[model samples]
Each structure stands twice: as C-alpha cells, then as structure tokens.
Target: MSLTRRSLVEYAAAHFGWRRAYGDTTEIDSLLNEQALTAYTEAADHAALATAKNTDALAVQPGVLDVRGRVLADVLYLEGVLTGARNRGLDPQLIERLDAAVDHGHELTVLLADTVRTTAAVHAAS
Candidate 1:
C-alpha cells in the first residue's frame, strides 16, 4: 500500500484525541524529532520567550540555543525513523499511522505558538 499524507495526519490526530479538522494543504513545520513533540509542547512557552529575548551580538544564548538544538536533533531522528520504517517494508498503513502522529504533533506546536502569541498580545493590551 502506498503512504499518502492524508492517512498519516488522520492517524496522528486520532491518537491524540484531537478533533480539529486538519487541512491537506496545511504545512507542518517544527524543529523536533517524532519523539520530541511532547517535550517541545511542555517547554514551548518558556523556551520561546527566552529565544525571543536573547538577541545580542553574541550568537549563542541559553534557552533559545537549547531549544533550537533539541529541535534539530528531533528532526534528524524523525527522518531516520521514517527512512528505517520504509526500508523495513512495514505496512504502508502502519507507517502512515506513525507519520500522522508526527504530523499531528507538529501541528499542535503551531497551534501552541499561536496561542502563546495571542496571550502575549492580550497581556500587552491589559
């Protein structure tokens, strides 16, 4: 069976009990491995804020650097997992399921980012 993007996203959302409709054209971007979604979400607010505040001449900051590094590691790990899964001749459906889970996690990150930004705006207004 061939793996399509649709099948993967559905599996991810279902695993998380997330009911929101995910569009096919929606792009998933993140700096994490498949296993790091939970970790990133748990730390997103503090990590994101620190990243935003650490602008200086010196490139290496603290929180932001750590977050970015972890994100890159996650992406690499995910890529390896995907490649390995495909190489194993795993059922297309099963592979799609894992892919969907990862995609869902990435989408959640985006949603979280949106929420954080909106909350910050509200705080600023008040």
Candidate 2:
C-alpha cells in the first residue's frame, strides 16, 4: 500500500503521545507541512542534479517521499521524547509502544528508500 500523510499521522498518534486536540493540531499541521515542502524541494534538487549529470533519472514523486519523510521525522521526535519519558520513569507499556514505533518507522523508511532506489535504477537502465 502507498504511504499516506494521514496514515503517518495516525501511526505517530498511536505510538507517540501526539494528540489531535486544539493546541496540538498546530504542531502536527506544521510538521506535516514542513515535510511536504521539504519533499518537493528535495525532489526538485534531485532533478537539477540529475540534469547536471546528463543522466535521465526518473522523477521522484513528492507525495510518496513526503509520507516517508514525515514518518522518519516523527520517529526521531518520538525517540527523544521516549528517552525523556524513560528518564522520568513513565509507564513501561508506553515505553514499549514508543520503542516498537521507532523500530517500525525505521523499517518503513528503509523499505521506502530501497524501493525508490530500485525504481530509479530501473529507469536509468531503460
């Protein structure tokens, strides 16, 4: 299945302590927007670099990368938060969930990156 912004948000909310309340919405929205913007910018930068190299590299889809980027960002943010929580002696169950989330996020990121790399390689070969 294709990665989606909503899914990424849901995953973070489920694993991390992200809330969908009034105050938290702003932060969540900002993170999503930032990742989306970064994804597009990176895609453009990649395209420019490919052009400079004179190789017909396939264009990376910003939407796909945006979700992956958000997932990675969320995982990193959660890891720090988890560390703080651990230091504060928070609930063991919550810590376990956060740890699982981080591991899952890393797996997803690697899989996505590999898929993108394989696709680009195929396109370049063609």
Candidate 3:
C-alpha cells in the first residue's frame, strides 16, 4: 500500500503495531490507512511520460512501489510486457501512483533526517 525509501517505516510499524495510530487518522495512521496521496499523483504523471523508446519511465526502482507492494519490474510481470510496453500499452494510473510514492518517500526521508539531526544537536547542547 506504500513505498518506503527506508526501513524506518517498518520499524515504526513494529514499534507502533500495524493497526495502531499515534496521531489523527487524517495526518497519520497505521500503514494500512496511510493515504500517500502524493504517490498517486506522481505515478500518474510518470505513466504519461512512458514511451516506446523510454521504458525507464515506467520503471519502479527499489525505492518506489505499486499499491500491491510490487516493485516496478514486478509491476510489468512479464518480460515482454516491459519490452513492448510502448506498443502493448502500460497503465498510466499505476505508473502515476508509483512515482508519487517515490516522491513522497524521499520527502519523508529528508524530514526524518532533519528531525533526527536537530534533536541530536539539542541533546548535545544540553
């Protein structure tokens, strides 16, 4: 249901439990409830950019994931699907969601890193 750049989310899930929520459901929730709307938006945009000459556009790296939790290569399922994606057709909406997940995953990673740095600095100063 989500693409995570780091295992931090898995750690959080284990710590909080899969179904537990620490904040408002709208802002935060169990991974099951996490909306990750930005992921959807980005994947759609990426799909639109996929071309016969540019299968890379549909690629989901280790960093991004489809709703089903499959990586980009798995999304295509068959090798021929990837080879002929431009001619066989790939779903733009699926690509959009994957791209969005990657974008948001990166954003969350940066935010988490900054928070950790700031907290460490404050603790050291104290």
Candidate 4:
C-alpha cells in the first residue's frame, strides 16, 4: 500500500514512539524524510524486480554516479525508522505484514551494509 504523510507520521508516533515533540520538527522531519526516501527506493527496487532488471539501477549504468552507497545509507536509516514504526501498534491482520516489512528493512540494511563494506574494503586494498 502507498504511504501517506499522515499514515507515516501517525504510524511512527503510534508505533514508533515518536513521543517527543518540540516547537521545531527537525527530528521528526528527518525521520519522515528517511521513511519517504526508503519508501521511494523500495518501490523502485520492486518495479525493477518485476521488470526482471537489476534492483539497483545504479549498478546498471556505467559513469552514472553509482548512487548505491547513498541509497544504501538511506535504506539503513529506514530500517531504524521502520523498526520504530512497528514498536507500538498491533493488529492480527496487519501485524504480520508489518513485522515482515520491518524484517525486510533489517535484512536490506544488513545486505547493503555488507555489500558497501566489502566494496570499500576491496577498493581500499587495491
């Protein structure tokens, strides 16, 4: 399902324990940005998967900036945000999927971290 700001923020506040609210929303805004970026990147990855293409579009083109690292950073940040998002809410129907989403986020973070670290190591060793 598509994520809306209300859904995202409410979900975070309800499930993620975003209890702290000051006059300035810098922290929440950062979280929201991370969530939106993650959602957008995840959707693009899904689309690429459906089309039988490389999920990381950056991996497809040479000299295209290869934003895999940046994307992976966002994914890693997103996992934390999502973990918080699922911290509170409960639903027999929705809980399973939400759990899976959080799990997926975690797995993505690990995978990306490993890949980036390995790549960096290789580059460093060279």
Local distance difference test values of all predictions, in order: 0.59, 0.76, 0.49, 0.60
The global Cα lDDT (0 to 1) of model 4 is: 0.60
Q: Candidate 4, residue 93: CA error in Å?
A: 1.8
RMSD, each candidate, Å?
Answer: 14.7, 11.4, 19.2, 11.5
TM-score, structure 3 vs. true: 0.32
Number of clashes in every candidate structure? Answer: 5, 0, 7, 1
**Candidate 4 — which pairs collide?**
16-84
lDDT of 3: 0.49
Q: Residue by residue across 10-80, what tens digits does model 2's lDDT show?
A: 68997887765435776768768978998998898877675676444355544446768888898899889
The runs of at least 3 residues in candidate 4 whose Cα sits more than 4 Å from the true structure, single-residue gaps closed, are 1-90
Flag the better candidate by lDDT, 2 or 4: 2
Error of 3 at 9 (Å): 25
**lDDT per residue as tens, model 3, 30-87:** 4434446656767787666654334442232222322224332343444334345445
Q: What RMSD value applies to candidate 1?
A: 14.7
Among these predicted structures, which one has the highest TM-score? 2
Model 3 segments more than 4 A misplaced: 1-89
Best of the candidates, lDDT: 2
> lDDT, candidate 3, residue 18?
75
